[model samples]
Target: MTICKGVLNSNVLFYKKLKMEVDMRDQILEILTEQRPDVDFNSETSLVTNGILESFDIVSIVAELDDTFDIEISPKELVAENFDSLDAIEAMVERLSEEE
Candidate 1:
């Protein structure tokens, strides 16, 4: 009975974490879509390298993300690789959120 309860608790925690990640990704996608309505963020992998998002766009996104997510994106965190894809942005946000 003790082992079963532990396994159940672990599963619940895993589900909660998975749900949080999905929610975070959805929020990030909304932010990205608001910044650029024309671009399809889901399909694009090379957001920076392909020149899909300009400098001003990045600035706006950074501000919005900071305000919405309550995460301070320092200068060092501002890199092309971090903003290159939806997954990258989601991963960055998760990392920052964990740090705080």
Candidate 2:
């Protein structure tokens, strides 16, 4: 059954999983926002070599991914295709979820 908390009705047990996705996207956006302060991050492909996100930023993103989502993204998975866009990243996350 759905439970109400204040003005919200959410399944408490699933909240963390839900929030993790939200937090991941926010963290990604924040990282990009800080690193590429002048670029239009919303529409471009995020590649380290493209100067959109540097290798250092990718390392930070990896750490955040592990901490925020309990997802272990390996070095082998650090392909340019994966970080091409926000849409690609979201699709990867969905694929990972299914694999688990």
**Predicted structure with the largest lDDT when compared to the true one:** 1
lDDT, model 2, position 83 = 72
Clashes (N, CA, C under 3 Å) per candidate: 0, 0
Give the Cα error of residue 14 in candidate 2, in Å: 15
- Model 2 clashes, total count: 0
lDDT, residue 67, model 1: 94
| Predicted model with the maximum TM-score | 1
Q: Candidate 2 residues 44-82, lDDT tens each?
A: 875544767667777776676566556778798787777
- Poorest stretch of ten by lDDT in candidate 2: 1-10
Off by over 4 Å in 1: none
Which pairs clash (backbone N, Cα, C closer than 3 Å) in model 1?
A: none
| Model 1 C-alpha lDDT per residue in residues 1-100, reported as the tens digit of each score | 9999999999999999999989989999999999999999999999998999988999999999999899999988888899999989999998999898
